[model samples]
Target: MNTLPIRPEIPWLAPLAGYSDLPFRMLCRAHGAGVTNTEMVSAKGLCYFNRGTSSLLNTHPEDAPLVVQLFGADPDSYHQAMDKTLEMGFRFFDLNAGCPVRKVTKSGSGSRLLENPDRLYAIAEIMVNKAGPGAVGVKTRLGWEKGVDTFLDVAKRLEDIGVAWLTLHPRYGKQLFSGQADWSRLAEVKQAVSIPIVGSGDLYTAEAGVRCLRETGIDAVMFARGAMFDPAIFERFHALMRGEESPPRDGEHLARIVRMHIQYTREFDGSDRSFRKLRSFIPRYAKGLRDIRSLRNELISCETWEALESAASRIREMQPADPLGFDPADVIPD
Candidate 1:
């Protein structure tokens, strides 16, 4: 019999596209995240030796317990990618079935696999068998549509096939983050499967994360958008669990991390590319500040690191809307 791996019960950073790259993962790790998964990588791309996709496998010495997530429907591609990933020194891997992006779903990958449990199971079995028992896991949504209990069967099937663990986002594919995530289904799915079940979806506050684990009895909690808003959330979660009050989300602290993020990104990917990439996240870092949208638009239009630094200097001089208590609800559009 294959032994089950010990599931990480602490708060983790969920794999987020364009956001959970190496520098961001390092920042979350420095805060308190026990594990950080890579953005969903394409197994087909790995099989075909795509250079851009292969670049996503980059890792740092500090990024231990990293989970590389792969998304694809081909078993052959999975096997090939597993070999390559192992060769690249990755010990933990996850199959992603929770992504709701149209390109991925239309390609018969991602959440589309939820429509056929057998194929999902087959692909997972192949991955686990090649990666060895307890080395491979899965992340998936509840089902293709709302009011469907398809995840119960999917979770059970994955458990029986010896998947290492399950990270469940309690939202249907059709919903695509439209409505509230039905966390009630998480409780039911956890009870249906023997494997560890980690809960995701709408976990913005430390209290919300604590509730998900306490109320639903999940093995752990994974933060997605929450981490984007504040990488220090991992630290906040730990403090809350220790019976301490939540930490302050002041402008000084936010500005410091934003600068640190910029520095780290520049070091990792160089100045120009990092500045371009940081555009998407500038608005997020500028939350709760006065005239942030306009500032964000200006920063997004900046062509060089010098211009970004100048813009950031202006932001530091201004006072935040609520200096001590930054609201998590004030999200800027992508």
Candidate 2:
């Protein structure tokens, strides 16, 4: 068995629902993202053979080392999902135990799973045993509530169960993307676990990714909202690591990525759902571009690709409304 950590040669693209589809994944990869995860698929959905869930697992020959993240509270469902994934030729899988949405937590899944250490261990053990050799991993937060410290125990348990890697989103579940992520806690978990720790949360810039790696001493940093705000973050980070200044933010470059994203969305999903999902990304990508807020509103009101294209053209032509006055990095959540 090879023992090297699964560190991507470049930064990773964190999974985001309605955003990390194949088009976006390809865009990030082209922009220098090393590893990318599929949007979270429900284990229960996979067990029941949901078509959308199955679509979420779609990958091309080039989308290698891709990890598909599954969420559910049932061990049986997890087993079934892994079996299905293995049959489909997927070698990398991650259990999602960090989502804190009411729907997920109310079902005793996601972040709620961390409240019980034994259950978390059992889940990881089952996946590792069933999936075999370097096949399974876990993504989790510190704990479900504030003032609680369960990450170390959870990380150790996952490591003991033979998890290939673990991604820690350093905020307590209850915090729910508010407040600063506890990077110190991530460092503590890094010290406790023998497995590679992928630090997540609040990594919004190339500088932030570097700082997180240096401070936490982890294997890699995962970008969530950062990738949404700036798909070129990975490319820029790579340049910075090579001692280059930041790349210029070009509206045309942003427009081209957005167009590719829209095309991929249409191909992966049908027109309606693709348009809806693609709309959410426009505002973020257009952050520093001039007149984008108005253009975004027009784009959102669009129903067809032609309408979206017209709006996109207008956006591409407009120079950033505030040159030297705004930062694209600031648009991402902190």
Cα lDDT of model 1 by residue, 211-271, tens digit: 8888898888899888888888888998988889887776577777777777778877764
- What overall lDDT goes with each candidate model? 0.80, 0.80
Model 2 steric clash pairs: 290-320, 290-321
Task: Give TM per candidate.
Answer: 0.92, 0.92
lDDT of 2 by residue, 207-311 (tens): 788888888788888888788888898988888778788787777777877777777667666557767777777777777677777887798798888788777
Q: Looking at model 2, which ten-residue stretch has the lowest summed lDDT? A: 325-334
Q: Candidate 1 — what's its lDDT?
A: 0.80
Reference-based lDDT, residue 72, model 2: 82
Question: In every candidate, how many clashes are there?
Answer: 0, 2
Give me the runs in candidate 1 sitting further than 4 Å from their true place: 1-9, 322-334
